[model samples]
Target: MPVTIPEIDYEAVFQSNPSAILLLTREFDIAAANRSYERMTGAVGAEIIGRNLYEVFPGGADPKKAPGPARVRASLERVLATGRRDTVGLQRYDVELPDRPGVFEPRYWSVINAPVFDTDGRVVMILHRVMEVTAFLTQLRQAHDHGITATPAEVEAMEAEYYTRVRELQQANEQLRTAHALEREIAAALRESVERQQRFVSDASHDLRSPLTGLQTRLEFALQDASDDPQQTIRSALKDAERLTEIVADLLELARLDAATPVSTEKVDLAGFVTEELGRRVSRVPVSLDLARGVIVDASPVRLARLLGNLLANAERHAFHRIEITVAADEDTAILQVADDGPGVPAADRDQIFERFHRLDEARRSDPGGTGLGLPIAREIARAHGGRLLLTDREGGACFVLRLPRSVSTGGDSG
Candidate 1:
């Protein structure tokens, strides 16, 4: 007797496979789904099969506002038209749970759609495969909550890993055609993100290291001279610590400004505000105020005060004998100017002066205590109020002009 051979059942293998998979007709209607797909979507085969893809998984809360359906349909149509496989990056899809009625759970998936052709070389069905990556995204979010910063190198590695998997999948499905335009766009965005992260890290590290290095050097010198007055050494270390604190505070302020934090705005009396602020500061330079009365503007008082203080301090540091303050308002904009009697900023250096951590050689040599963040912070504050602070040309010294919109008001003049 001849031995009998058993026939292979490929349909049974597909139905029992662990990976979530769906078979769709040429019309994009679900034809069959594996056990894993049914479990993943919490839908019975009887309920989902023979239904349109979008009908089964409605895109988002608002049909008109969502891009999910269009994106998925486009990929499927591409596979049907070209008889090739298509891979999509991460997608956000919320699913309704069978156990919980009227409730949808957020889910993310990486999907691949491949064509299934007939004997005549015509596509008849689509094989849709999905891998759930919600847990991986959740882990990344949790790491952010724990104050873990991702480096540019780490981001590049993650992007490379994603494309490597995509390449492998394309190789496995030799008929797959990669979307070159989408790939180029993603690469450009990732490159930009990496560049921004690198610049931030470099600037932050440089700013932080300067004061720390000074503190270390001071401590070392103190240790070397045991007989010298310990109080003076302690005072010097305290000064360095204070400087570090100021740098950290400025950095925080810059971050907040960059984030566009909301500010409180109110009508401020310009003349009185300037008078009160000037009274608080004591400088050897002769200060003159030529303030116009009834000059008022809508601004955040705290921010305005800080801006003015920075300008005044800068002028005082550079002034040889006199510092002048002027306030005037026209029909549309209010103008405030601060002028000093020292060397004016060079035309070439004026543009770079407002950059964070930037300092002129002469300014640095004269004012060693300056953290080089004051002018930048002032400019940001000015911009936050829909205004501008500019370095205007002056004959004898640097002149800073602050322009702001005039607020509606009625008041008396105070010179």
Candidate 2:
């Protein structure tokens, strides 16, 4: 009796594949390859079909090899014998193609393999599915080849073995660049935090020391007076105690703000906020407002108010008598500028003034804090809200501009 052939879907095999496909007989001859396979390998039906695996491009001379080991023939033969599948990294091989510029270069492949069965249910072919991972592998090869420990000959051999992988190399470089930027930012942030902490400690120490010294003097005088100075001494001691308590309170507030790193913001009108904020400064220094109404911003009202309030306080402390305030919002930003008539920031000190613990020469006259943490804290808040604070050096006085983006602003424009 004759054996009947079982129906198999040939169209679902090589021809229907989205990727390159091929069919090879048990003897390692190309029975067929799909259109994608031809395009991927840059080989034709006439050249590849009916050809032995090694006959066309033995030893991987061509850029793409038909499902076989280019470096180790013995291993591939074993896979064929066992009718099994495998995967490899960075295999340098070639396929014969029409000569184009630099056609001599060996194309590398990241590949996987499997076994195909015949109609008789016996293993008849080895299948290959390859992905190009050249760019990434190229960097790995270069890093390995040029290692500090490698001898010249070893380096030469490794380079010789290196197959170019542009994509992987570019990807790795970009990732490294991003990581380096983050590292630098983190390092700068850490340095700023340390300096701010130091300033807080120093200022508080000085504030405490003054009161303590005064208390000591009062105690000594009271001792000599013997009951005559009791009232004065008690009052002086109470004053010193209050000063110390205030210092402690300030320190606690700083610590609390730092501990709660990320704060939520509510959408609040910028114009109204500025108007209310400026109202407090009313006439202490003549103030002008050009606030555009209906512009809303996303920020913890408390933090944003603190930021604004500090700037206003600075102006009040330094201004010759008048301050100008303006508010505006563009497509994606809300801008607020405050200018005063005091001695403007000198060009040399503008950059350093924002640094934690940095104080301008004039800043000391306005604030004993000369603690220099206000600007830094303001900056931190701006960044947290996706915005920034910049100081402009103008002749009339120092103008400080705060830029808040739409992400932080709720009422930008109605249209």
Name the candidate that leads on TM-score.
1
lDDT of 2 by residue, 99-144 (tens): 8633444566665656787787667776656665445545555664
Error of 1 at 273 (Å): 0.7
Error of 2 at 91 (Å): 5.7
Query: For each candidate, what is the lDDT?
Result: 0.83, 0.69
Cand. 1 Cα-lDDT: 0.83
Residue-level lDDT of model 1, residues 295-398, one tens digit each, is: 88899998899999999989988999999999987666788999998998999999889987788987897797787889999999999988999999999999
